[model samples]
Target: MVGEDIDFTRLAVILCKPDAVERNLVDGVLERIAAAGVSVSARTDVVAEPWQVHVAYRDTLTDPGRAPADRPAYLEAAFVGRPVVVALAHGGPDIHARLRRLIGHTDPAQAVTGTIRGDLGSDSIAAATAERRLVRNLVHTSDDPAAARRDLATWFGAGRPAPVCDFENISVVLCKPDAVERGLADDVLERIAAAGATVTNRQQVTVQQWQINVHYWDLLVDADWFPGRDIPACLEAEYAGRQVVVALAHGAPGIHSRLRDLLGHFDPPHAAPGTIRGDLGTDSLTAASAEKRLVRNLVHTSDDPDSARRDFGTWYGARRSGLLAPLLPAQIAPADA
Candidate 1:
C-alpha cells in the first residue's frame, strides 16, 4: 500500500504507440514523461494482442455513435507488428492531468505546441480517416482517473503495485570486474550504506557478451568513450568473462547522483581523494590505452532514475516481483516510539 500521508499520489498509464516504437523513440518519450515530474514505476515491451486492444478500447469500440465499424480492426493493425512500451507512471497531485497535458490532444494539428503529440506527432485525425488508418500519435495516456485505474488494471494486472516508485529512489550499481577481482566490493558497498542507501538486492554473475553489449550500447558508439578501438571486442575482453556484483540500492530522491558522487570519476587517477575510485582504484586511462585495456574504475552507478530503471530492466527482467521486494511500512516503523 502507498504511504498514508501521500495518498493523493496518482498513477497513470502510458502506451508508446507502434509507430514510435518502430522509430526508436521510446527513450525520448520517457525523457519527456520524466521531465513532467512523473516517475516510471513498471514497464514492459509487448506486442499488443488483439484481445488486449479490444479490452483497452472497449468503450470506444462499442460506442457506435463515436467509432466507425472498422476502427477496432484498424487500431489492432496499428499495434500488432511492433513492440509497444506500456509503462505505469506515478506522481504526487493531479498526475492524470499532468500526463494528459504532456501527451496533448488526440489530433496532432490541434494539440498545443509544447506537448508530446504536438511536437512528435505528424498524423492528424482527418488525414488518418482519409487514409482509413489509425492516427499515428506517438503515445497514449488515460483520459481521467477512472480511465487510468481501469487501463492500469487491464495492462499490468489487477493487484500488483508498481515497483520502483514504491521507494523514494531506486538505483542500480555495479561493482565491475576490477573491484570484484580486487576484493573491494565490500568496501564500495560499505561506502554506499554509509551514505544512507539500502542495498535491496545483490547478485554476482559472469556477464554475457550480449547483456554487456546491450548495457553499454550507447557508450560503445561514443568515440570518446572507446577511442581508436573495437568497442565490442574491448567490452568482451573486460566484462564478458568476468564476474560482477550487480546491486540494487534504494534511498531518498537524488540517490543516483549521490551514489555516482561516492563512486567518483571514470578514471581513477582523476577521481577526488576519499571517493571509492580515488581510494581503491589506481589505473589510468593513459595506462589502459598503453596496455590496450579499459581503465579499472571500481564501480558503476546509474546516471539518473531513467537510466537506473533501464539498466535494472536490462540486468534483471522488468517484472521484479520477488527480486528485492520493498519493505512494508510495518517493517520500517520503529518498534517502540
Candidate 2:
C-alpha cells in the first residue's frame, strides 16, 4: 500500500560502503521515491572530513560512561570510512518526518524492514548473509524533524542555494574493454548523465591480464574462493590486454549510485535487466566456453577519492601521461605515466 505524503524541508542521508553501492538495491530506492512523485530539490556527494565526522557524532564523544580510548578509535573508524551523502529538499508538510520513516535509522537493529538499510545491510565486517544487517548498516537518515532541519543547515546550507550542482567533488569511471567492444559507451554515459553526474575526464585504455592480476592482486593471492572468484578469468588470453574506456565524473548526489547501478557488476549477464548489463551483455551464463562468458561487470565505480586515486594508479596512472593536473598535491593524487 502507498504511505503518507510528506513535504520535506530538506534531508541528507549518509550512505557508507565497502567499495561501491549495490545495483538492484539502491536503484529500487530511487525508483520507489520517483514512483511516489517526489522531486529532489538538491543533491551532493560529501566525503565526511574528520571534523565533519566529529561534529556529526558529537553527542557520542562525551558520553561520560564510554572509555576515552574507545571513543577516539570509534571516531577514527567512522571518519575514515568511505561514505556518500544524498541530500534532498521537498515541498510538503511532514516531509522531514516522512523521509525519516522512508529511510531507516543508523543503528542496524532499529532500521525498518522496508527501508534501504533493512534490505541491503549486512555485517559491517562481513556480508555473513544477504539479509544480515551491518553495524555500518546500509544508510543513515536523520533522527527527527528537528535533527533533519539542523543537518540540512550544516550539510547543504539549508536550501540557501539550489541543491543539485557539481561543485562538491568528482567521479572516476572505468569503462572497460567490454563496453567499448560492445558499442555501449554512449549509452552508459547517457545513463550517468540522466542520473545527474557530470563527466570530467574520459579516456580509453588497453589493459593486460597481468595488469588486472596486479590491480586485483590481493584477490589473486587469496586462497579463499570468494575473494578469488574473478582472478582466473581475468588472466585468460582471450581477455588479455584489451582496450577499455576511463572517465573522471564530477560528483553530485544520486549520480554515483546511478552510474554504478547502470553499469552493473563486472560481468554484465548477471546484472539485472534494466541495467547496462541486461541491455548490452553478450556473454550469458549459458555460454559454451570461458571466452563466450562475459567477465565480472562492465564498469568500475570508485568508492571515494582515496580509492579512486589508488585504483587509477593501478589502471590509469600507469597509462595517462598528464591527466588530473589540477588535483591537489596532498590529496592522494593518482600516479602518472
Candidate 3:
C-alpha cells in the first residue's frame, strides 16, 4: 500500500547539500527549481546523518565508478554533521529527468551555462580532486522513478519528514498588504531571523476575499466597535486582490507571544521603537479611520497555537499537509506553564 501511494515518476526528493546551507543558497536554489514548473514543498532542514548520506550516495560509496578511492571521504566531509535542506518536487512523469537536467552536471565546470550548477556553483571537479574531496555542487535530485523511491525512504524517513508540528514553537507570519506593497517583507523577515527564529516557506499570496473574510472574522463580528467603518467593505477593499507574504517561524516555546511583542502595537504609532511595525511602518489606525480603510499595520502574527494552525491553512492552503511537521507529545506542558 505504501508503494501504491508513491507518485513514482511525478515525485523527486531534493537535497540542498551542506554547502548550499553554509552559503545560504537553499532559498535561491529552491526558487530556481520551482521556477522550472516543479511544485516544491515540504521544505525541511536537517543535520546530515551518516547513514542517510550513505544510503543516498550508495552508488559512489559502493562502486565509486570513475570516482577516486577517496570519494567516500569527500562525500562524508561535505555532508556529515552539517545542515542541509530537503524538499519534495512534484511534476509530470518525467520530473526526475527534468530535474536532473535542470541541476546540470556533477562537476560545475562541465555543467551547461543555463543550468543550476553552472550558474550558482563555484566549486569544481578539478578543485575537489586536487583537495581529495567531492565537488560542492549545491544540490541533488533523484535520478529517476526508482531513485526517487529510494530517496523518499532515505531522506524523508520513509516518506515522513522530521519536522514535528511543534505548535508552541511555531507561528505564522502574515506580512499584510502594506508590507508587500511597500517592499518591506524582506526587512520584516530579516528582523525575525535576527531575533533568533528559523523562518521558512516564505510564500506570496494574492488575497482572496473569502480568505480575508475568514481571517478577520472577528472584525466583522464586532463591527459596532468602529461604528462608522463597514468591516466587510474595508476587508474587501484592502485585501481582495492585493499581494502579501506569508512565512513560518520556528523557535522555542512561547514563540507566538514573543513575535506578537516583536510586532509591537497593532497601531504603528503606539508601538515601541524596536518592534517591526514601530520601526518600519508609516501608516497608523488614526489615518485609516479617517480614510475609511483598514490600518496598514505592516504585518500580523498568530496570537496562539490554534491561531497559528488556522493562519497556516488560511495562507499556505490547507491541502499542503505534507509541509507540516509531526506533532510532539500532547502530554508535555508549555514551557511557561
Candidate 4:
C-alpha cells in the first residue's frame, strides 16, 4: 500500500489488538479467517505506540458516538506499549465485509453467535463505558480501501526485510488430533524433547480444511491410494474442527529427518518398540484398512527442510511470523553517532 499500488479489493489489513496477544488468540483467530477463503500473510509483531494508535483511530477516537467519552485518555492507556500482531489478508473484493461479519459486532456482548468476537470475545461495550474504557474487542479490519492504505502504514510500518526461511536445523511437529483427543500431546512432545532436540512454541490449533489440505497435499494428489472414499470428505471428517498440537523442534542440520525417524512408521504395529508410535500410538493400518479410513498415527514430523517450512505455515498460520524469531539471524545494528 505504501510503496506499491495495492489492489484494495483483494487485500485487507488485519490488526490483532493487544487483547488478542494477551489472550493468546491470534493463531486461532487467523486460522478462522483463512478457513473462510482469505489468505493471511506477512504477520508482523509490533509494539503499539500512542501516535500509531492515534493515527489508526483518527476517524473515530475523538467521536463519542463510536468510542468511549474519555477515549483520548483511555486509548493510549489501552494500547500503548502493548504488543499487537498485524498482517495482510488477501481475498476477494468483499473480504473487508466478510471479515467484519466474521469478527462480529464492535461490542462483544452484542456480537451474535458464530462470529469471531461473538464466539471468542468477553468484554462488552456497556461494561467498557461504565468503566470509562475502550471495549476489548479482539480484532479490527480496514473499513475499506482507504482505511486499508492507512492501516497498512500505521500497523505494518516499513515492510519487514525478508525473513530467513531456513529449515535445515528445524522441523515442525504435529501431534495429530488422535494424540490430542487421547491426551497424549504432552507425552509425544516429551519424547521429541527427550530425543535431544529442543521443542518449543507448542500451540493448539483448531483444524481448518485449508490446513489439512496443504499439509496433506500429497494425499490429495495421490487420491488413488484410498478407493471408495471422497478424499476431501474423509479429511474434513477426520480433522476439521478437531484440535491438534504443534511445536517446533530445533537442533543441528537434518533435524527434520531425525524427528521423522523418532516418530516411527505410521502404523503402530510396524513401528519398533523404541519409536514414538510403537511406544505410545494405539491405532493401526490394519484397522484403518478394514474400516476404510486412514491410519491414526499419533504424530507427524516434517519429512525434510522444505516440508518443515510447509508444516510450519500450515499449522501456525501465516500471521504468526514471530514464531521464527529464534531462527532469524540477528540484525547488525549500525553504531550510534
Compare the candidates by lDDT and give the number of the best one.
3
Number of the candidate with higher lDDT, 1 or 2: 1
Error of 1 at 35 (Å): 1.1
* 10 residues in a row with least lDDT, candidate 2: 1-10
Candidate 4 weakest lDDT stretch, 10 residues: 326-335
Higher-scoring candidate on lDDT, 1 or 3: 3
Can you write out model 3's per-residue Cα lDDT over 1-337, one digit (the tens) per residue?
1233445777788999988899999999999998787767667788888899888998887774665677678878888999999887766788888999999999999999989899999999899778777889999999988887787666656533343466787899999988898889999999998998877667788999889998998999999998889989999998999999888888889999999999999999999999998999899888999998889999899999999989989987786544453221122233344
After superposition, which runs of candidate 2 have C-alpha atoms over 4 Å from their true positions?
Answer: 1-168, 223-233, 236-239, 253-256, 265-270, 285-296, 318-322, 325-337
Give the better candidate number (3 or 4) by lDDT.
Answer: 3
The TM-score of candidate 3 is 0.73
**lDDT score, candidate 4:** 0.80
lDDT of 1 by residue, 189-232 (tens): 88898888876446676898877887888867784756677777
* lDDT tens digits by residue: candidate 4, 145-222: 788767876775544332454688779999989999999998998889899987666677899889999999999999
Write down the worst ten-residue block by lDDT for model 3. Answer: 326-335
Per-candidate local distance difference test:
0.74, 0.52, 0.82, 0.80
**At residue 62, what lDDT does model 4 achieve?**
62
Candidate 1 lDDT at 140 equals 83
Kindly indicate the candidate among 1 and 2 with the higher TM-score: 1
Residue 53 in model 1: lDDT = 81
